[model samples]
Target: MDNHDLVALSERRQHQVDGVLTAFFRESHYRAKALGTPYATLWETLERNATGGKRFRPRMVMAAYEALGGEEPERAAYVGAAFELLHTALIVHDDVIDRDFMRRGGLNVSGSYRDIATTAGIPLPVAEHRGMSVAIIAGDLALFNAYRLIDRSGVEGALRTRLHDILDEAMFVSAAGELLDVDFALRQRPPSVDEVVEMERLKTAGYSFEGPLRAGAVLALASAEAEEALAGFGRNIGIAYQIVDDLLGVFGDERDTGKTTVGDLREGKSTVLFAHAVGTPEWAEVSDWFGSPELSVEQAQRIREVLEAAGSRRFAEALARDFANRAWESLTSEALPDAVREEFRPVVASVLGRVR
Candidate 1:
């Protein structure tokens, strides 16, 4: 398939997924009204947060299913919707953990509640707590709905069972990764490159890419070998994707990336880039600035310069490219149909050019 065909296919898949999401939210809003005022409000907040993302996870499911010869677009839509809901839940929870008020340059789920409470004249501490509480419950509801969507997807009972098992494992692994991430941040010292990469693989890779792709393969009744190949591809590419994210956090323009650029440095995230920079000569000049609440854009730029001079930026970019290449090789290991392979080729181009 050519670029135009790929773009057209993506648009169609996006429309179908949106249709499923709209129907789900409409029904959820109706059901929530009977519960209470808070329930209704929370449901509305979820609907809003769910509306904005690129819906990348859902597209992953569709691509994998189609590549594996799954013919029913409606069936793929159901699976895509389930994965998208799962993505929504995780991001909501992640925002709470990160204490981030904005996503894609707009108020996030917790941020919305926080803003509402603060606007009502609640004290800062109390308002923040209340917002966090609402967000926690909102995330929980999203997760529950994700599983519900899959359960009602009308696939064979046996297939659904396998999919659930895959999802359950992914969630469990992701929770552990989240725990490790929190610990890594709280530690006195930065993590090693291997430690950071392991955390990323468990956290973002499993749920964001690996799980969705594998779930689609299961829906298509793909062989074990195909699933294995896709799993490897997903994990490696997901890591590369996260590395790109880390790069963007420090260097990308907020206008283009649609999020603040200094968050990672302020959070003192132990990315592979950080690991690469630690112990270098440049570390002494800026080690104290990371994790500082008072971090300035100027200081951020200085640190970016240090990271660049220390070769960390090149290190990370090279690592991402290497993984992208490996992911392509892994994808080709399976006898994926040619058309499917062609569809996936764009993923390499997209990932490689993400920060360019």
Candidate 2:
């Protein structure tokens, strides 16, 4: 699809998701009045953050739903919106946990709240504390809101129970993945490939791909065979997304992938690309590139050059394509409907081929 096709696809999917979300907020009353000051600001902040994202996870869910013979576009779209909200909430919390100041080209929850406090003449330290406190609570509230969106969804019965179970378990895995992120960050030694890939699955895949899409599919009472197949497709695609994300972190244009630009290098992110470079003989300066307070921009550029020269970029790119091909294979393997399956190839290609 060209840029026009991409725009149309995005518009159609977003409209469907938003209609459901609007109804959810209206039914739940959003409780905006109950939250005070900075806490209330979080809702506005999350709303601001939610609307502009790529919508890939929800699209993944919708695709899986369509693939499996489910035909209600509105229902599929709303489910996708729920997944988007869940992801937005996760990013809000993650930024605070990482103490990041900027996200998606703006001051994030913590930073915005800090600015609010400072503008009110609060001391810098006190303002910073208030910001962190408010942001944490805001993330918690977003998480609560996520569950409410799913639970109060118009759909009901034992299928809801199954969906709830899958969501709960996926949430645990996401947390476990986050824990590994922190632990690995603290490690002085390089992580093994096995550990790195597992982190990609937990921190990056299951919820981002498997959980949300499956939650939607199960609501349609997707068969056991269909569920397994979709799960495999999501898993491979999710891992591939993470690989591309890691590559972009180090190599993408600063203006395109606004979040985590150079964050990987400064924080020594343990991605597959980095593993390949460090393990290879070509990037002999890999350890020196790990980063230090004194490392200059020039030094960073040279290190990136070393990684590329070692074929880390090529390795990661090939792996991402391989995984995407596998995803297409799973998607078309008699588990999904004809219309959904027809678009699956295009969607996967478009997403995997993104530069940033």
TM-score winner among the candidates?
1
347: Cα error in model 2, Å: 3.2
Tens digits of per-residue lDDT, candidate 2, 152-174, equal: 55667887677768777777888
- List model 1 lDDT by residue over 1-356, tens digit each: 66788889899999988999999999998999999988888899998999898989889888998888988877878888887888788889988998887888788887888889999999888887788788899999889988778866787678888888878888888888899999997888779888888899888888888998898888888898888888878888898898888888888888888777788888888898999999699888999998787899899889999999999999988888888888888888745666556767788777888744
Q: Model 2: runs farther than 4 Å from truth?
A: 1-9, 23-30, 34-39, 123-125, 258-260, 281-286, 293-295, 351-356
TM-score, candidate 1, is 0.96
TM-score of each candidate? 0.96, 0.88
lDDT of 1 at 316: 86
Ten-residue stretch with the least lDDT total in model 1: 334-343
- The collision pairs in model 1 are none
TM-score of 2: 0.88
Distance from true location, Cα of 328 in model 1, Å = 0.8
